[model samples]
Target: MELLQLQYFLTVARLEHVTEAARSLHVTQSSLSKTIQRLEDDLGVPLFDRIGRKLRLNEFGNSFLRRAERALFELEQGKQEINDLSSPEHGTLKLAVTTASSLPNILREFRKKRPNLQFHVQMLNMQEMITLLHRGEVDFCLSSPSIYGDDINTQVVCIDPVLVAVPKGHPLAERDSISLLELRDEWFVGVKKGYGARDLVDSICESAGFTPKYVYEGDEPARLSSLVEAQIGIAFIPSTAKNSNEHIHYLKVEDHDLVREIALLSHKSRYISRAALEFRDVVVEYFGEMA
Candidate 1:
């Protein structure tokens, strides 16, 4: 019934350990347990199934948890809306991104216009970004390959062409464009499998009848350019990230229309602050000019 009770219950459900949940909430274990007990009594049903020192959400708990989460999310959105009304120009824009290559430019332009607005940006994988969006943890998500959900809205900001980066002296470097099938025998340098670029590359390669033979796999997409420049391996680089490195040559994929869509995503029903709206506009305009 009480907001504190709901908060405590949610934390406990997430941690599934009374001691750990109590520690996280900075309250004593006994006090936390008493609070949970009171909540169950008021509801006339037990929320969690006891399992020694660990707790699991029962069927009743599962249903209540969803409603509790939405209730808290609405309350938080109301608070944020009031704050935004008080100071439209100053607030933190919480954002998550699957790709950050274009963010520096977009954020720089936004910062120039709204100097007082703050940013909390997280570099997350596609799934993590979607999860946070649904949880109302992030105001917006800058994603590649587009995220789709019933309550999620997406706007395509840019269609970034994926190009092959090869050492200038490589045999394929003489051509302005080449098919992925031709690169089947060549070793590649790319970000790890879970990355948006990597996933796109894999799908393209699979369609082209071969998987990429990676000589080097890393977490940093930026390193792909340098690795290819060293003749370690070739890589797939987005056109937006094109650099003037003399040792590297970027080739277009002649066989496949190799491109990824960069999208701005937000929850349809969530409240977006003025600063967040401005940030979104900057993202769209920045990419719009590029297109």
Candidate 2:
């Protein structure tokens, strides 16, 4: 019923002990118990099974707990967004990025300009990024590699030369560059399904007249490099993906002239927060210089 009641219920359910919940909530046990009882009465169902001093969500309570937590979190997020709207310093910014490599300098520029802006960045795939944007989970996303249509507004932030990542000792590692056609049958590592980078790789492969045989699946840039370093497979990644490892060799792909376009995306119907809008300008300024 009440948010505080839901909050207290979650705490009690999580701690599984009324004493701990009451201590954490900084309230007397009797007060907390009465609050939980009142919430149960309002909902017409019990939220916890009282066993001595312990509290646990039963079958009905468990299901309610999940929904309650989600509802409570959404309410909290909405409240914070409102507070942020009221006070710039207290606002929360949510950003989803298909892959961090796509926009190499965008985030850094954001940090410089929005020194005090709080952000929650989800390392999600392309579909998730779009869904998050539509759901208002994130104000906007850093993307340019997906199949999103007219529902969202976007701006190109950067361009990155694509490269083939390989183990240091691989035959192709010593080459300064290789054509996409040259690695036709080579084993590859790729971002997981719905990842914008995976879509980019697939799009490029199709354009080059071959289907990539991805042997490993994940969206983590570091893991892909590890796969390359172990000689397990090669990966197509932005040149910036070369950092943070020494055993991997990254060779720019020639002939294809592959370049990943980094773009900022937001829902057409949604208004981006002021901080995000300002950060977008910083991104444009920092990466606009790139071809």
Candidate 3:
């Protein structure tokens, strides 16, 4: 029932290995085990199913985890709220982003206005970002293609057009625009499958009757343009990430609504600090200027 026990349990559940969790928690393995045992004794239920050295959260554990996470989230929010109330001018802004290409400029502009504010930003995949949103772990999530949920508030801050990038000497570069079908046969450089832009492009291409043949797949969307410039492969590059490289040509996706909706996401029931509100305003304004 204690917060420390709950914290240790959550860590163990996430890692699924007591020794590793103990290491992460910076405690002795025996102490961690004893704490977990004490927690189980209080609950009168086995939270985990043990398999050798690893632990799998059981149904009881899963059920308890949800409530535990919410309790911790609320407690953390209370702390943040108190801090915000005491000193509204300087507070940490925690954010998760699916795409980081537009983040530098957005953060730079926000920093100019609130130079005293601190930022903690994480570049995560779409699902990870959404999970954090649900957990109330991040103050806001800058997502692509927008996420929807009953307890999540989403607003599209930017609509970045997705374009095909080709080397100047490539045959596709001769055209003003190319259809998704036309690129089906060509090799592509793209972000990995979980990325919002990558998923959007894949969905569109699937609708267009073909899956893109990726010659190179990576986590970084910004590198797609550079890969195309090197003639490694053509790629679907968002306009927001496009570079002014003379060696690369960006082609429009003819007859398709090829765009990524950059969205700001927050938990509907979670407390948002003044810093978060100002950061949201700055994000909206920053993308507004681009649009």
Candidate 4:
């Protein structure tokens, strides 16, 4: 029933391990357990099912968790509102992005406008970015292969064309554009399975009647271009990733829908600070001009 107890319960629920949650919350295991027990006692139902050292949320806990999260989110928003009102230029902007290629330009512009504003940025996969946005952990998320949810609002900031990157001396490097079918037998170096670019590439290749054969798979999307430059393998590189590297050839994809939408997302119900709103405007305007 107490606020601290609710905080402890939510942490335990999220981590699903008393010891780990305790460590995260900087509280002892016994204290966290007692707090959770108090919450369950007040609710008149057990919240978790225990299996050895692991804890799983039961039906009651699952139902309660949603309300608990909303409650905490509202409280945090109230705090943010007060902070924004008191010091508009000193607040922190929490953001997550799938790629940092275009972000430097956006952040540079934002910083020039509001040099005092702080930033907490993370480069996360699509799923992790969605989870953080849903949990009200981030102020805004810049993602690709745009997500749709009832509680989320998104705007397509930019449609970055995906191009086939090859080494300067490669056979296809001289072509103006190439089709996916032509690359059926070519070895590729691509981002890993869960990445937005990888998903788009795989889906397009599948539709073209073949699976991409990747000779190398890595988590860093930025490195794919370098890998292609080294002639390790060809790769699908976004227009935003087009750098001044003379050793790489970025050929357009011919007769295919090879593009990713960079989206700006925010929680529909979460409070947006003035700084966050300004940054969002900057991102929209920056990309809009580019388009």
Candidate 5:
């Protein structure tokens, strides 16, 4: 089947609604439906189940969807590879990262070094980053505690100590160090699950024989700091998730502390593009010295 047809089928399968898929792809619903029908006829297997005008992938459709998605992803990556080879320094560099305090410095240095380089640096959650990398949407990813994939290669780059963020006038702010048990029962603004910092908090709190009162989550971890400053909560943020707000204070954890292992990830078998390699070197050099 044609690549376009495969794409259409994939979208319809994901959304489970031809109309919604058409809207997302900026096409007429009729045209999209016809395309899927054509694909099903050519394949001699029905790809979707129609239920009251809504569409969902059938058993065969589910299987086809996975293979089709992988094919499309490889095709796109091949195109990007060709483009990269034709103009090594000019093609786009798609990178993904989780929210970390060191993110700013890396962004700054990358921009400063290659001002003209095209880049799409996505700030995604850990699971999202893994999904994107596996799907070939991103060439590489950076995360904490190192995410593992079947074909992925990873290397630890930095060590992130768990730190407590409190309001400026809060009691813990005045202390140089605090224990996990001392903060038990306190309200906390949590990071999304699977994030390095969030895992650390979860582990530490569990060890203290108490669960935290989490009020918020997601990539914009600074919201937690804002909540802390407002006296709404406290957080066990990573050293990278800095307390940029002057109204908040950060205290180092004493003993029985948690630490996040920052890592760089890429598909093990994928050919390394020159630009990607260069960027990787930049990252390695920067974090290596810091460590």
Candidate 6:
């Protein structure tokens, strides 16, 4: 029934592991267990089913979680609103992004406008980013593979065409454009399966009548350029990833509809702070200039 209990329960529910949740909450497992037990006692029903050290939300917990999340979200929004009213010029901006390629320019532009404001950035996958945005944990999220939900509002700030990157001395280096079918016999380096870019690459290759044969698979999209530079494998790099890596050559994909959309996401129902709004405008303008 207490606010602390609700926070602990929500953390536990999200993680589903007592020790992990305790570590995340910076509390002992015994204390977290006692708090959940107290919450269940007050509710007159068990909230979770224990499977060894893991906790699975039971029917009661599942049903209560939505309400608990909304309650916490509203409370956090209220706190943020108060903070914004009291000190509108400066506050921490919590943000998450799936990729960091375009972030430097965006942040540089944002900093010029609000030099005193602090930024807390988290590098997360699309789903994690969306979850944090929906929960109002972050002020905004910039992500590729745009997310959709009733509570989420998104703006497509930039659309960068995906390009095939190759080693400078490679056979295709001189080519201005190449079809996906031409890369059928080439080795590839790509982001992991779940990534937005990776999924788009896979779909594009599939449409071309073959799946990409990746020699290396990694979580970091930025590393793909280095991989190509080493002549280890070719990769699909977004236009935003344009860097002065002279050893790598970027070629357009002929007849390939591979493009990544960078989106700015915020909770539709959450109150937007002036700092967050200004940062969002900077991002939109930065991309607008690029277009």
Please provide TM-scores, in order, for all candidate models, with all chains considered together.
0.92, 0.66, 0.96, 0.97, 0.89, 0.95
How well does candidate 3 match the true structure in TM-score terms? 0.96
Candidate 5 lDDT by residue in tens digits, 116-145:
678788877777787777776677788776
Candidate 6 accuracy as TM-score: 0.95
Residues 1-291 of candidate 3 have per-residue lDDT tens digits of 799999999899989998899999999999999999999999999999999779999999999999998888889889988999999889888999998888999899888878999999998998888888998888999999799999999999988999898999998778889878877789998989899999999999999999999999998777787788889999888998888999999889987999989899999978898778888999898888888
Best by TM-score: 4
The lDDT values for all models are 0.90, 0.76, 0.90, 0.90, 0.79, 0.89
lDDT measured at residue 120 in model 1 versus the true structure, 0 to 100: 96
lDDT tens readout by residue for model 1, 115-145: 9989899988777788889988889999987
Higher-lDDT candidate among 2 and 4?
4
CA lDDT for candidate 4:
0.90
**Model 5 residue pairs with clashes:** 101-240
RMSD of each: 2.0, 6.9, 1.4, 1.1, 2.3, 1.4
| Candidate achieving higher TM-score, 2 or 5 | 5
Q: Which sections of candidate 6 miss by over 4 Å?
A: none
Q: TM-score ranking from best to worst?
A: 4, 3, 6, 1, 5, 2
| Model 4 residue 106 lDDT score | 95
- Candidate 6: residue 109 lDDT (0-100): 88
For all candidates, the clash counts are 0, 0, 0, 0, 1, 0
Q: Report the poorest 10 consecutive residues by lDDT, candidate 3.
A: 220-229
Query: What's the C-alpha lDDT at position 100 in model 5?
Result: 54
